[model samples]
Target chain A: MSELLKNTIRFILFILVQVFILFKMPPLHRFITPYLYYLFILWLPFSLSRAGLTVVGFIFGLSLDYFSKTPGLHAAACTLIAYVRPFVIGLLISQEGADKNYISPSIVSMGWAPYATYVIVLTFLHHTWLVLLEWMSFGSFLYFLGKVIASTAVSLLLVLLTELLFFRKQKFRTNTI
Target chain B: MRNVFLFIRRHFNFLFFLVLQIVSLSFLFRYNKFHEAAFMNVSTELTGRINEKYNGIEYYFQLKRTNESLVKENIRLRQLLKENYEAPDSNRRLVMDTIRVDSARSILKYNYLEAKVVGNTTALQFNYLTIHRGFAQQVRPNMGVVGPQGIVGTVVNVSENYATVMSLLHRQYKVVVKLKNGAERGAIEWDGLSPLFVTLKDIPKSAKVAKGDTVLTSQTSSLFPANIMVGTVYDIVPDNASNFYTLKVRPATNFFNIEYVYVIDNMQFEEQKRIEDSTRKKVQ
Candidate 1:
């Protein structure tokens, strides 16, 4: 499948899973809301420009927000992470290396450790922005901290699980976008 | 003009990011405020329809529990029938009235519309529930919603086919309630902690309070009817410096498993509010 088609399918699947399954799941803990939908933004092909990435992120997040009835809460967070994803990836991977290979950031292409760090940093940023916006105030800093940490941890685990389960042995495409 | 164009070209990505961020943040703040915009919520046609469809599948799993609750409610209603009660003196004749009015039968105060819970959340600091009833069904913003067992929340936003309820578990949600025994009224608020409990504050130290004491909605509230079940006092939080005692209350409604609710409309709410506003303005 073309990369565009693949990512589009992934986007729809993510929104459906996040809204129908994850949002509807009975609360496991007060603090642990697993947000795996942003993984679509994280999995976009490397050739996409920064502006394009941000727009995609905004749309992806807005789609989730539409279903979950959170309005722009996810959109803001997703935009933040999308804008920062490139910087985080650059810090971890060399420019020439990223350009030459790696259709997208994944455990197979970026190796396990770097891919894990990429997911962790971006997920933490996303969750922090989301939780803080949802809260709209810092009445209890500890409670806020707990929510961000717990939710980020759960979301990271889900992202990693998706990585290992589906993209465990995928080969990087050599063709350009 | 050339310099400005150059600057825009140089920082197009950042500017785009900033513009999108500002738009998103504006939406977050604007709609997140208490009942400003309703189009972005789940009550909108597309999302509401999707949720209703999904609720259809999820409804089957809760059938047994829902039926039991319905049966329990029926029994409670049946027990309240006038036939079950007899006058102390058999000489007095009993009167029956289908309309819910005072002895004069002049006015009706409260009306209830039943709604199915299409979506709900208890884990978030600001939680809301989407119900299948909306403006088309006479459900409107500011109406009080109550579950089978107890008070749920108030309707905040409504579309044509659905309405969104601001759950009592939400941090911004508050209502006036009083101790059933003492009649000392205080505000009930959720502390962004557990959905099972809320905090009752500002009750004077003079009033007698104890664990397991029942709390009910007070006459001060315009949204809910008086004597509606709010919760039971669970524990007292010690605050020696203040003259008021804070009590933790376990809400009567089990928010986690709520499936159905009643939207309560106060017929005189607008009139009462208008008069109150005019009185305040006149005083000012």
Candidate 2:
């Protein structure tokens, strides 16, 4: 199969498993609920356009909201993460504005530190939105903090596992190369 | 101006992340009861499926126990049916029986809707179980649901063929419960730590409470019928923190080992809810 076809299929499967399968993980800790659906957005090929990423993020969120019945949560989170993707990628793979075909995110390719930090920050933001939006009560602010941290840790672990198990190592490329 | 535009082009990623964060945050800031309900529905599907997948090996080992338990339950159900037929009631007692029983089973007049477990899990702070029943099954947003063991949860969201259950283990699960004596009352809340235990919140400190007391559902709950078994009082702590007493609970249903459950249809739900809506609106 073509890379695009493979990516698209993988995207659908991850979305389904994350939203319908991982979304309902009962709070694993006092304030922590694990969400792996962001993996779909996380694994998008690096060469994707900024606008394309945002649109995919929005649709990804909306589709999950449709199944989850939570109106616009996933859409909002996905868009936010997508919008931040370029900056995150830039931080890890700086080549002085030389545009190269972006492979998908993998620790072996992005380096353990960059890939791990990328998932960490993005997953933190995603869970923060997911939990605060659902509860929205200031009375539970402490719980929300714990939830964000715990959930972000778990989500980061899952993303890294996927990278180690499913992804491959590749060297950085410059357009001239 | 040229410098500003160049700066914008160079740092666009930062701006993008901010915009996305703002959008998601705005939605979260405006969560309504519907949003909460919808989230719960999705949770049921997610958790229920995970639970099913995780428990696959354990399920095989427990088949013998489940069969034996079902046999005992059959005998006990027969006793209840016999007593129900003999007792007199002014109302027809129009609640649905979740199990399909023989003609010898008590004749009930309510409708029965069967739901399959799609996702469930217990290894979390606040546990919830989701099932595959929805508005298509005529399961509404607040109907009572049960498994073979006892009450599992109430319906929180309903779609075409999917519904979510706010399992008893959820932290926000607050239902008014009365003790075996029916005089004392408190609210039931899961501590988000153990599936085997729940905490009774907001009970009057003055109410006579003791360890080993049986807790039952109070009639005040909109979803559950009165007197459904909740748990036994495991610990009673004086909330120096608050004016109420907190009692630890042991849930009657062990959520780990079950597949099928029954969605109850309260035939009078519509009428009752209608009256409640009108009254609340009038007061407002």
Candidate 3:
């Protein structure tokens, strides 16, 4: 299947699972709520423009908001993370990987540590902004601070678990004579 | 002017982010109220259909539990039937051979509309439930919904064939409840920490309250009928700042596993509201 088709399928599946399953997870902790749908944005091929990334993020988050009943909280968070994606990718990937034509961000392509950092940063950014906006007008700063940290940790774990289950190492072409 | 345009061209990404953020935040704030828009609710046609399809596959797994609750409710209802009790000897002397409608009849104030739980969420500070019944099924906003165990929520939005309920787990969701057979009244609100427990606020210090005592819906609320089981008091703490005790409640209905619910149609709700509104207007 084409990369476009594959990513499109991934997008739909993530939205479905996020809305129908993960959203309904019985709260294990008061502050922790798992959110792994942002994996679609994290896994996008590295070549997309910054503008494209932000737009996609908005649409993706809005789609979830449509069903989850939170109008724009997810969308704004996703857009912010998407806006910062390129810089994070540049910071993590080596020069050689940057020069490559199509690098799908994953454990195989970006190595485990860099990929993990990428997911962590993006997930943290997404959850922090999401919780802040969701609890807008609340007086308890410490409580929301705890919420941001706890939700980020839970989401990070979910992202890593998905990586373990689904991501396979891609064969990178070595430099030849 | 040239420098300004150059700066704008240089930082276009930031500009894009700002625009999108404004758009989304507008949506976030605009429809935050209860009945503003249908687009964000699960009651909308497309989302409702999708949720229904998903719930169809998930419903079977919950059949045993649902059946058990139904059977228990049936037994309870059967015991309340007039035929189950014999007339007293003193009353029997005054009783006529003709069947008395008022004496024999068990008046049912709230009619139940059985609905399948299609979509639900409990992880957020504000959570909602989407059920299969809606405007088409006479399920309207403010209708009380109860699971097999206890009170669930009130319907907040309705489409042609689906309704969205402001779940008991939501931070903004509140229900008036009182201790069973006790005069102490309080309101139940989720603490947003655990799904298992909600905090019951406003019970006065003088009111008798104890652990494991049953909490029930108060008659003051128009949404739920009086005396429906809400939960049992798990713990009670006296608030130093106020003259009330905050009782920790273990909700009777397991919100996470809710599969089916019955929406209540209060027959006298409209008349009751009309009278109440008129009274309020006169006072104002």
Kindly list the per-residue Cα lDDT of model 1 for residues B141-186, writing each as its tens digit: 9999999889999998888889889999887888999999979999
Tens digits of per-residue lDDT for model 2, B1-284: 99999988886866665666565555544433334533444544554455456456546766886777567767878878744564355587555564556652444434557776655656543344567677766888777777766678877766566677778877567777888864588888876666778888877877777888888877677566677777788987655877788788887776776566778776766777899999999999
Each candidate: RMSD to true structure?
2.4, 6.7, 3.4
Residue B253 alpha-carbon offset, candidate 1, angstroms:
0.9
Candidate rank order under lDDT? 1, 3, 2
Q: What is the TM-score of chain B alone in each candidate?
A: 0.93, 0.75, 0.87
- Candidate 3 — which residues are off by over 4 angstroms? A96-100, A168-177, B1-11, B35-38, B41-43, B91-109
Tens digit per residue, CA lDDT, model 3, A22-115: 8877767777788889888988877688999999999998888878877787889989898899899889985464426345777777777887
Candidate maximizing TM-score: 1
Q: Pick the candidate with the highest DockQ.
A: 3
Per-residue lDDT tens digits for candidate 3, residues B1-284, read: 99999999999889988999999888888767644443554426578899889888888887888788889889988999867877667843554456555664445568889998888888787788889887878998899999988999988888888888889988778888888856578899987878888999988888888899999998888788888999999998756888989889999998877888999998888889999999999999
What interface RMSD, in Å and to 1 decimal, does model 1 have? 2.0
List, residue by residue over A67-107, the lDDT tens digit for candidate 1.
66567889999999999998998887744575457678877
- Candidate 3 yields a Cα-based lDDT of 0.83
DockQ order, best first, reads 3, 1, 2
Q: Which model is ahead, 1 or 2, in terms of lDDT?
A: 1
